[model samples]
Target: MAKNTYKQDEILEEPFDIRHLLRASSYIKKYQKRMIIAILLSSLGGAFGYIAPMITQHALDVAIPDKNFRLLFSLVIALLALYTGSIIFVTIRSKIMVEVSQNIIYDIRKDLFEHLQKLPFQYYDDRPHGKILIRVVNYVNSVSDMLSNGLINIVLESFNLLFIVIFMFLVDVQLALVVLCGVPILTVFMIWIKNKQRKAWQAVSNKNSNLNAYLQENIVGARITQIFAREDENAQIFQDLSQDCRRTWNTAVRYSNLVWPGIDAISVCVRAAIFLFGLVIFGEGNKSLGTIVAISSYASFFWQPIMNLGNIFNNFINNIAYLERIFETMDEPVTVSDKENAKEMPTIRGEVTFDHVAFSYDETKKILKDVSFTVKPGESVALVGPTGAGKSTIVNLISRFYNVDSGRVLIDGQDISEVTIHSLRSQMGIMMQDSFIFSGTIGDNIRYGKLTASEDEIRKASRIVCADDFISRMPEGYDTEVRERGSMLSQGQKQLISFARTLLSDPSILILDEATSSIDVQTEKALQTGLNAMLQGRTSFIIAHRLSTIRGCDRIMYIDDGGIMETGSHEELMAKKGYYYKLYTAQLEEVHKTA
Candidate 1:
């Protein structure tokens, strides 16, 4: 798979799709009752608005000219009452839709996050995390109003436009036809800009995603940027991304801004035409003053909804871009999920076997090819290999982080692929090259391995990994707060804490890849006593560049060229004087030269 990058936009091949809205209806369906009530309230408020013009016509034609002060005062009160009712209904509808919109956003963000968790490492590997973050947070937020209030407004405005037309025709047929002319003019203008507007908004979304991806990457790698004196270059890159975002946004807004003004201009022209036809062309004798006034008001009412509909449609076009991105993430395939009939793996006895396993990250090259290996329960095996020679891939396979391309991995004679991933992985402890520490107390970080673990368990695990020494020397001991990535701790301390975290899980099989690379020789020597004690009666795979560390293991496998080059007790391999002997002697010579 091609890696997704911040330098380019994600290609979306689908054109403006209504199916996006149809699929979104599932989320709306959960709040259908509230949406219906809100719609009805909005329509009711609009109905009140519709009656105001007729009341004004009545006041002018009947009450005011006839010198009936009482009737005039009553019409004033009625209009006030209608306005107040409209305000009340609109307020209530706004509140309901706000709640419904928030709920929909919550549901979408939650589902997106849950799906993201199930995606394989390759999914994350192929894309910048910032792009994923923007979709889950920013893109999901942008669609809330469109999904809720915008949907309701679409219905309300359509009805408002329909009723305005009916009321105009009833007032004066000729004037009504004049007002109707504006509809086609407005429709043509909207159609002309529709595709352009949609595409522009889609560009805006892509640029925003790119900007977000770049921003997040810069923030995370700020330290490295400073170390390499690349701040000026990075800032220039950020400025370019920001400029692209602004450019796309301005283009989208320019298209959107054209919508209302076009409608308003058509509206004004249509109203002027109504007066011209009613008073002069059609003759004032045929059309009464009251009829002229009512129809003119209806003309305003007519285009108001059209203008509103244009704005709503504009919002829909903009938000639909974000909506598609959100749905795309939700629809990402979970390549490492449990099989349909997969059962919970029975408690692992730590017997791990790879039967002719062949694997690759992508199709172009294979990482492991037709390899076979087995480690008996309670054996401590060390894997030593040159970098990128499938050392980490071997341990990752045991955890089923990626399914093998051609063969099976079995645990105690049962195929791991036939069991639940959770069950298989839950029984294994894996400590990788990077030790990530969340922002929390040291105890909280360790307790992540066993959520129900007590303070004693945390301390015990820390002691086992020799993390307790530095932790005890701290001012707050176990309660000392650590920032994200444990910036306050040294690399060795971070590794020690991570080691404790893995040890706290009490996994049946423990795999540590370059686990002690950061620690000094003295600390590594000190850690070995507890490490040896912890390895008793458990199956463990240790990968370390320091060949001195694996000499005590029951067996050592020198892995290279997509298969194990040699396997034996350290002394036996040393006597054989093959690949393992040469590599070990080379490392010793380099160390003595450095000393």
Candidate 2:
């Protein structure tokens, strides 16, 4: 089996940032009325919870001693009212928060998607799709519980704790002080447990992202694994990844386990202390059985809020890591956004130039250096070279897919950076070597180029690329469904559809990057006739490895090592016996050997 090449997950070690939490909460501001109402209802419900114990103490102390059946019945009825009100308040609060949480989540997801659309190509090139997917979908969900219930619980429970403490003091100061002492101990324990669990949850999140990335990569390359009969080997690799995720998840679960038990133990110890202390007071006649019972009730009530608050706080800490991940994506600066004063470009005449342009995907390794070139309006130019010879880079620069690191790329005497990207790209059509065909009908995909394109124009474009022939032969003709990535179609058919889509856009500057590489000889011949007609009165750049495909171009340029090695018409370069001549002859010899 090949060694596992995936890198280990990078566990984030930074301390939790409160700013991310604050920013996440800011989304709720727009739902202010709903949140306020929820908080009010929840608080009122919690206040009603204290009434039952008061009634219990009253019945045992005052009504029983007096033997007042009427007073006992009245107390029972009041207790029922309190319980009923509490339930109603809780129900109403839950309904409001549910809608509030959903709306906030919807807004966040929408903003993230809109931001992704504006990010430059290089941003996507550097990150895995699954990692980004988790931030936008899964991570957002991780924070939902905390956002929906955390704030409401904190508000209602804090009020309950305050009221419980005050009520206990009213009943008996001695027992109240004892209960308060246990709080500091619980606070110290909470801090220690919370910190440990935060780190553990972060580790779990990292492993989850790693597992997602691995799964996505394997699924996309499932065909390659099957072709090589390496299914067992790949399964073993996946098992290792799954085991790593499981181990991290267990670690997080262990930390969570420690939290509630520790709080429960503190509650038990406080109760024991309260009971023992109450006996001494009862012997001294300073507190009656009813007063002691009421004090104990308040002590239990006190721990209820403390336990609840601890759980809410723990959830918030756990969710901080996910919030940070989400905000990190939002914080990424758009490297290629349009200038504030950028103007919408007028319909271009399609003259393109690169003036001493240099570019590097990274600072350490340059892809193109000090390269200069020009393509006049309506000229058809073919760039031919071996792989890694910068032919594709030149075309990319012309289309502004990647901005030049140094120097300028100009179209019709205007720097590309000076114009709005939308207006500029709308007039330029780029069909990459591996075109992406979205899931839709054949006619729908064609109309994707120009959404308002008429059916007549769609058919005309398809006929111009020779795609209409096979398209018409399909069972549903143009209405046939092209499944995900056009997976159901042959390579040649997908490329032809891509061409038809590009042609329908009516671009002033057309870029075909190895566009015809997939078609067979007969299809290529038919495509060439249509391509020749399409090339007239529009500037076009073709990047090709096949020498025969570009023979009719107005000029052929041989590129190597980030520079133009030779430039001339095909016949001129053949006569010169230069780099182009050798490269073309080598391909011709290879063709004859295959024949």
Candidate 3:
């Protein structure tokens, strides 16, 4: 059995890899043209910004000193135009980027959901639902800005840094060289914290996933917890998980906080050195006041983009953890998907055969071994055994829920594995032990069996399964709305609704695995007549521990010890007094004792 809890530390830890980023770039390819246009607009805006320092120097040195009002006025007007153009470019770029990011997010989410639909039952059975959910929702949302605006900003900022350096040198090389000195120092600091920051953010991601998993699990099992009087215990567990999330978040923030201050310190020192050298050493009474002012402005401009780049880098490191998870889910192998060139299954005739099939969920133990059986068209076969004796496994194999480890499962004389899964399962009606009812009106839930079914068709099916009585007595009758998972309804009511749904589908084969276990004895008896009519022209597989329910089946197969030990009519099995007979008598004695 799968474990109920998955610890945070148990999640796989991945090293920092550039390949992840490279793979993510594939999503951006479709919007490359729009991205390029946005980058150009942003770069143009940045270019207008670079011209501001030069304008300042020209006004201070020539326009102001020459007492030329006309030149000064023109310069003021020109500066205003430059600022206006920059704002326009930035506005346009922001709009474009928002569209691109949302599109990328939609595409990614669509693909992830589609892939999830194809994954087999074992994949979900082995992992917590919350872990899978975080990848599809939270993780995907976290990476959207990074993949879209973040990529553009990286390019735009690098260009801004380059242009600032060039203009600084043109004004005066000595101060420019002093500004360059901080590069190596900042580079060393970044390298020192690179691995530490990445690992810390990865821990944060894991902790958050663990918290979500526990929260969802508790919410779903809240009624059980209250019944067991475990509120205090579960609360303590939640607190522990929340504490881990807080601790990891603080650690990651500490590493991220180092970047801004480090850049500021270097920026301050660089500005101070520019003054000392430009005036004391290189100045020597030769440096113009305007030259010093222009270089100073250039110095501030240069460091600004460096700081912005540092912030972008920080975001990349943090969101990379989320990105890895997103791609990891996308890259998960589809273990039970349609084969290449697989043919669509033709109309089913209700013939199912298992040819010496052997199966195992894991390598530890086999669930079914060398099991061979054939049920003719329109036959009703009952499977009964102790828990974990491959009763459900047998019905599940008939539906091809899991591929056989060896041999084959055939339907209508065709190997099921060679046919497309959609076409094969669409014709089969399966009602599991837990009948899941989606949130909708009563009529809508019943109509789920056949999307194109009419209202009359829905009522007919509900009547056949004996669900119409309770449904009609409800306040809104067929129009009554149900809460999520049909929490407002009784377990017996949910089973009845599920039965109506199965019947509405008009399937050629029906498999019921404890479908009526939750219903009261009276209700079960009342529905048996409708069930018998529904079973008349279709092959059926019924799995129940209540021997009385299966006594009327055409054949009863006692499944145990990895194969069928008894196969005969109910009377024949009773005469043999083997496994089936012993189990049936034991159940009767237990029922008598309870009565």
Location of the lowest summed lDDT over 10 successive residues in candidate 2? 1-10
Q: Write the per-residue lDDT of candidate 1 for residues 135-154, one digit (tens) a residue.
A: 88877887877888888888
Q: Which portions of model 2 miss their true places by more than 4 Å?
A: 1-6, 64-67, 144-148, 280-289
Superposition error at 403 for model 1 (Å): 0.4
Colliding pairs, model 1? none
The segments of candidate 3 whose C-alpha lies over 4 angstroms from its true place after superposition are: 1-5, 10-18, 314-321
lDDT of 3: 0.87
Candidate 2 vs candidate 3: which has greater lDDT?
Answer: 3
Q: Per-residue lDDT of 1-595 in model 2, one digit per residue for the tens?
A: 0112245665455565878777887787788788889888887887788767778888988999999999999999998999999999999989888888788788888988998888778887777777787778887876876777777788888899998888888777888898898989998998888778877877888788878877877887887899999899988988988888899899989988987789778988988887777777446666667877887788778887887887787677767767776777887888776899999988999888889999888887777889888889999999988888788889888877788899999999899988998899999888887877899899999889799999899999999999999999998999999898888899899999999999999999999999988889999999987898779889999987677999999889988887888899999999999999999999999999999
TM-score of each: 0.95, 0.94, 0.95
Sorted on lDDT, best first, the list reads 1, 3, 2
Q: After superposition, how far is residue 232 of candidate 2 from its true place, in Å?
A: 2.5
Q: Which 10-residue window of candidate 3 scores lowest in summed lDDT?
A: 1-10
